[model samples]
Target: MFGFGIPELLIIGAIVMLIFGVGKLPELGSSFGKAISNFRKAADGKDMIELNSKKDG
Candidate 1:
């Protein structure tokens, strides 16, 4: 894991918690997951955009 052991990861995680605080962590994680998901879809030649339309009668 890039030469990062448990102690180094703990320190890094602590720093992130201090910087972003506790509340914003889940929001950040959600955005990160979405970004990776989109990246994978694009890499796999899948359409990442959706369009919806309705016709009025």
Candidate 2:
């Protein structure tokens, strides 16, 4: 993907692991997932602020 081959991907993944560490991987992944979800919702014209207010109320 993105013009990256297997070796390039493995190297990038290793660098990420070194920077974030193994323990923080899950938390980072969860945050990334949430961000993608929010972006998709926003792209679909759903307002996040209104949704949050509704949830809180």
Candidate 3:
């Protein structure tokens, strides 16, 4: 997507590390993963509320 290759990705990653710092990378990755998961669930019409309640019980 956007014609971004390995070089472009490396540059972008370096910029992100500079801006957010290495310590924050894991947090950022977790947040990104959650966002993608939520997006997929919403697109598939999955009910998160019910799933959460079921898991708790």
Top candidate (lDDT): 1
Candidate 2 least-lDDT 10 residues: 48-57
lDDT of each: 0.94, 0.90, 0.92
Model 3 residue 57 distance off true place after TM-score fit, in angstroms:
32
Q: Indicate whether candidate 1 or candidate 2 has the larger TM-score.
A: 1
Candidate 3 lowest-lDDT run of ten: 47-56
> Model 2 scores what on Cα lDDT?
0.90
Model 3 alpha-carbon miss at residue 28, Å? 0.4
Q: Give a tens-digit lDDT track for model 1, residues 33-52.
A: 99999889999979557878
List the candidate numbers ranked by TM-score, top first: 1, 2, 3
Extract clashing residue pairs from model 1.
none
Q: Over 4 Å off in model 3, which ranges? A: 48-57
Q: How close is candidate 2 to the true structure, as a TM-score?
A: 0.78
Q: For residues 22-53, what per-residue lDDT tens digits would candidate 2 score against the true structure?
A: 99999999999999998899998885565344
Model 3, TM vs. native:
0.76
lDDT of 2 at 31: 100
lDDT for model 1 comes to 0.94
Tell me how candidate 3 scores on lDDT. 0.92
Could you say which candidate leads in TM-score?
A: 1
